[model samples]
Target: MGGGQQYPTTCFNTVIKTVVLAGLLAQKPFKHIAGFTNSLLKCYAPDLHTFYSETMDHIHRWNPNLRCNFSATVSVFAAATFNFRPQTITFPHLDFANLAWGWCAITALGDFDPNKGGHLILWDLKLIICFPPGSMILIPSALICHSNTSIGSHEKRFSFTQYTPAGIFQFVDNRFKSEKEVNSTEMSAEERAARVEARKIRWAEGLKMYRKCPSALP
Candidate 1:
């Protein structure tokens, strides 16, 4: 993904999110990207092949439709396991599902550097993730937000971030609505007072780390 893509608004906590992102980002290259597991003599039965097989199996279980989007089909494999708030309102185009462990092939393993290419960011209280490939992490479905930085055009980045049963909601639109409403109208005296109360509520609601987007990135 690039700069234009964004993730959903989350109600999930930060520490748990940090743990998940760090786990995936810290995976050993070979285990993170299956192709590295193939020794010279074992080239025929490469990790890529095994990973694909496993991914297909997991997809079948997670999505009964067996549907694969154009973008999703092109990237290497990866899987995220989490539970979502079924009762909360969701974006219209986003998908959610449970995934089996060891799914998806390595898309871009050991190929990224912090400075060279755009990085993966799991944004919540702030930008909390930078995935390096092959390591697996679990995040809360309802709270984690993720997106990648822009990469060079000539360079190849085969990573894919997917949510099964996708297209059920559109997350960006919701964020836009909230952001616009908060920015557009001028606040009346009473409204301004109420806004302060709202802010206080957010602070009391364990959103102490609630943050504004970075000027350089957003």
Candidate 2:
């Protein structure tokens, strides 16, 4: 998040955005994993899905060799994670880093009885859903506080999650420039007011892009 335009950005682990144009990139075998997730997004939230897909395309156009094209379609998410390393129940929290109106995909895995434990808790909805193994669900995690129940000590539970951070969108919307670059520039009062107004409109503009689920995945 601290990187400047035309520079590589990373979080040491789970995220690495580079603009290096040199070297041959090896084929990512997990393209199918990403592909499947993208399909889920398309099925439930077509408009939001398109937004992410187009954003990736825009990224490629912004930097012809930014090293972000891990898959042909760029899939959907900027990042994916596995929660299987050590089974633990996630505490209720909002994924404030993700785009507030966009979705985060979640899939349950491992051996755990849904009736006994490992239910998804949507705090705002006041619902504790039995998340079946291998079932996938999408939610606006940035807007919702959610978590899950702890599994039995003898049982195992894992989760897969996909999301793109709001910073990535901010970076793109700022024309690939970092916030510091924009803020440090000298501007007239009118220009400053315009920028503030633009910021104010972003949330409302984004809300317009949200869509209801078309139908259940067949």
Candidate 3:
């Protein structure tokens, strides 16, 4: 999803988003959630856990107020955004605004036949995953093309999503400067080159964090 896309803002959406965020950030299950998320990272994209943890920690430390504006309370990652989807099939799309190497956490909710409906389609991965209620998946949304198959008309399907945007981290690292502001700054050729080199190194280091592990998900 684009960062600028208008999310549903009705009371129901607000309440559900709040409840899910609260659970992720405060409930006892949060520990399990963190473990499960890390386990998934270890299995599917092992290089990302450190980058994810460090980015989240940085946001929490220096940008504690940076959170989803749509959410009523603090979210799990300070730079993360919250989205709620219910009973609707999402069209195939890349979450381009999210960090390309960072994981997006999605928790499925509501009653539905896993074999028949609410299947997550990872087009790039060539997998159709049966997403049952109360289960979660962590994926690099910006790097994967994904969508969902329709549910039966009588069935219910809901999902809560949490993602951190690359721009947010960039802003934090740039001392809270917006891209435009950063671009407008006058810098010596050496300074600009140094900055670019630093970014390249950071990106490479982030990718190196992933190590191949046995696949855990079917």
Candidate 4:
């Protein structure tokens, strides 16, 4: 709802608007899940969460007319997805359109035994995590290769996810304009060269935002 690859502006999905607007028919089932995931985002990735929240707020402030249900319902996340195909399994892939440093919340639901199936396969990390129903996991969807193992034939599974597109952050950072708009203006030789150098330093600074703790990786 916030932003997507196809369009540079903050917008809504027509299909989702008609279907799974989180707080549409009252906040009963989805609100609690959204709130809990928001808390976990603050707990596990305080700085990242803060950055994303503030940026999303800035986006709203910048685009006062934009109305998105997911961001209004979830607050911190820009978009939400529902994967409910009875036997919900995915092939390994990276969400390349999402923010590289941003975390995506994934919650598995319905009847599935973690021991038998429905395990999160973090291919790049060489780890297979047990994913039980109602389990919420946060991961760098754009940076990591991940998927899930198949559940039993008779078993059923559904998933809800929240995420932000890299274009959203880019939109805010480029002074409320898209990269294409920013690039349209001609840059002087010095300006171009300076920006090239700044990118390297920004990458290093970006790494610092990942807070370190003794309990990390444990």
Candidate 5:
């Protein structure tokens, strides 16, 4: 007797996107959403609804490296919405403080490999929480951080992060000085290589952000 074949992989792309976009729309400004939608349409091609509803579905089913787990998928869309917010919104003493929030979401076409593409890593801190696929991760944006691991050959990485007003305030690297501001000149080749190596090791060991909402901040 013939037997039925098993499924190759689960399709979670659409579910994740729907959840993230819903969450973003609930909080973000309407003008920001419109601008984001326009950019998204151009990037995905065939327009917003078509890309999200149809093309995304088709690619997730057939494309190899383009697919991602549920959490990664949702986090990316959430980040995208957050990143697309208008610049008119005022913040306290900071220049575009989006990166301050440690909470970020990313999707890789395939497995997490450091040598090939960017991977998630907690900067200047250790992992406090890790939300694998199917698990939700909510954290104080300033307390947590993540980086993208490398993607496989010919694959793409899509990701973004969210930050509340305070998280932005906390993450601002006040000590950071641009070349124009600093007296120092160029760096040695050896120093550049060392920085690259240091970055590699940083991403190799994964870290998590602690859970805390903006309302709880002191």
Candidate 6:
């Protein structure tokens, strides 16, 4: 969580991941996590539940062997990875693995000034949002370029993030096959054209899902 490393990448080392995952399962902190995610989905992204269910259902149908990270009642997927930042400023970047249509939830914790510290910077939206302790936000992480502003040197800051990877859904859809295998599959010209068109439709649908949200920043 520290060392200024980004996760779902090497920055989140194995030791930290193992400890955090074990704690979550043993403690069942998902009560708070689930409550926050569901409330945000209901208020800002009304259609998110439908989208998440549909995606998960599709994955289950294609690959029965695959399992979602979390129970259906808790989260859309097991939290991809949790990021723990301690009074550190992050560089602006987009999450490549997150689904463009899915929302990622982030909650701030620890002691920091609300008015002048630990603000969220949404580069594309041009917003420097106040992020007070215990406050959470749900946004399309894969689509938005975001980072955090600096907190006071003496004050402490920490945050927890939850997200699902689009690649996981794609993997399930491919019947648990690797990406290379899926790409190597043979297809007729007509079939290839149809597949390409289908991808375009799905991409457009994903964009619409983001646009339809009443509050994209929440």
> Which candidate has the top score in lDDT?
4
Model 2 Cα lDDT, one tens digit per residue, 1-218:
32333332533432232222112123343455567778877876787888887877776677676445246464767666667645658999999878999888888878888899989999999999999777778889999999999888888887778788887787777777777777888989999999999989988978876665658445
Which sections of candidate 6 miss by over 4 Å? 1-20, 28-30, 57-69, 210-218
List TM-scores for all candidates, in order.
0.28, 0.81, 0.71, 0.87, 0.25, 0.78
Model 5's TM-score against the true structure: 0.25
Error of 6 at 187 (Å): 1.0
- Full ranking by lDDT: 4, 2, 6, 3, 1, 5
What is the C-alpha lDDT profile of model 3 across 89-125, one tens digit per residue?
Answer: 6899998877767778877777889899888999988
Question: lDDT by residue for model 6 over 195-218, one digit each (tens)?
Answer: 678778887776665444555554
- Candidate 3 at 41: error in angstroms? 3.7
Sort by TM-score, best first: 4, 2, 6, 3, 1, 5
lDDT of each: 0.36, 0.73, 0.66, 0.77, 0.34, 0.69
How many times do residue backbones clash in model 5? Answer: 15
RMSD of each: 18.4, 4.9, 5.9, 3.0, 20.8, 5.3
- Range of the 10 consecutive residues with the lowest summed lDDT in candidate 1: 164-173
Model 1 agreement with the true structure over 65-159: per-residue lDDT tens digits: 63332223232333332322221112212122322221222133334454655464556646534545343332323344544565455443444
Flag regions of model 5 displaced more than 4 Å: 1-118, 125-136, 167-218
Candidate 3 weakest ten by summed lDDT? 1-10
List ranges where model 4 is wrong by over 4 Å: 1-12, 15-19, 22-26, 70-74, 212-218
> In candidate 4, what are the lDDT values of residues 34-57, reduced to their tens digit?
778887777666778788888878
lDDT of 1 at 16: 82
